[model samples]
Target: MASIVFAPADLVVATSDDIKVRFAGADLAAELPAHVQAPPGAVGVRVMVSGVRGPETMQRDSGFESARLAWYQQRQDGGPAREGSAPTMPGMLVLERVGALLRDDVGTECPSVAGQVGGDGTEWKGSWTYLPHPPEAARTL
Candidate 1:
């Protein structure tokens, strides 16, 4: 009864134990070393992309609340402390990079990135969704 979140591109990461196989959160736990087990409720998966990958699953009560908090602080602080952040977690910025950041004002100025690579190279583009407030009373949408 666990839910999953998949990245548009694949991801690669390691585990506490050493086992050689593509790593995902729910589907591939059995293939992992005996020590790999999902917390009480979760799944398994694996994805390898762009020199970055990791297990892809989330928990209902995970520290997501804290994640947004840190993101807010970082965004407001403007990354002034790039060298050191107080208590870092892996998935902290991911929520902003993907689906969640699509609606934010960050991309207001769409810079013309392509058309001038000069060698037919592809430019990278991205968007995210942001809802910085608490769900209002959980009423019908």
Candidate 2:
């Protein structure tokens, strides 16, 4: 799997067409296609969380459901943006917590918090690494 690290400030923004993922210190943006099977050599996307601050309890709420809901909603709208006529594949969005990794195989459909004290405690700050799953053919090699 190939990995892309995202800093705390990096934004993973979702749009009507695609999810814009930014890599730290780089201008590269990975557009995760929606509602389609990945092409012959498409890679899947996974995220690993690190540098989390706060109690260990927060780890339990890995925010998988919320992510899945958002992904489903996005696809229901229209799906990710495409570059050309070439059909793009929808990659999985896996969220890896500190100890346990939650896998959300984002095929067709699939599925956080932290913040100030007394402020819902639903906000969390951390760095995440994006691991791209190798193409099916490559995995067997």
Candidate 3:
């Protein structure tokens, strides 16, 4: 199993087909050099996972292994610019599928996705556990 950590202020948007993690602006400012100019309303780094199947369940781990992963950098104009795709360099995302699991959370089983992704000296190894969404009433509270 792998572990992924996110700051409390990080924004994570997940759907059935994709997951996006946008770095916090304050974190970016601290990490980036003073000469680096971040566009307005855009984060410095964004990690995106797409083409994922069975993300809400563990019935299709094989398909998840083949999911597409990519990262983007914000342009000077607040748009995403794809990073590092030279012919000699490996692709931005290289999957090393470790497997998937269903975690027992107080008797409720939740989907857990674990894998190693990246290439050419950069890699992110982590597992993401997804809890079911709350009911409408719960959300309104």
lDDT of each: 0.28, 0.31, 0.29
lDDT tens digits, residues 1-141, model 3? Answer: 122334344443332223333322121111222343444432222123322323432333433333323222233334444343323211122223222333323344433222224443432222222333222233110
55-112: candidate 2 lDDT, tens digit per residue: 4333323454455456666666766622223221121221122222323334221111
TM-score of each: 0.18, 0.18, 0.22
At residue 23, candidate 2 shows an lDDT of: 24
Give a tens-digit lDDT track for model 1, residues 23-126. 23222121222343334433222212121333342231145446647766886787744445454333323321222111113323212111111011111112
As a TM-score, model 2 comes out at 0.18
- Over 4 Å off in model 1, which ranges? 1-14, 17-57, 70-87, 91-141
TM-score of 1: 0.18
Candidate 1 at residue 2, lDDT? 32
How many backbone clashes can be found in candidate 1? 25
Clashes of 2: 9
Ordering by lDDT:
2, 3, 1
Model 2 weakest lDDT span, ten residues long: 110-119
Worst 10 residues of 1 by lDDT: 114-123
Query: Which candidate's TM-score is highest?
Result: 3
Positional deviation of residue 86's Cα in model 1 after best superposition, in angstroms: 7.2
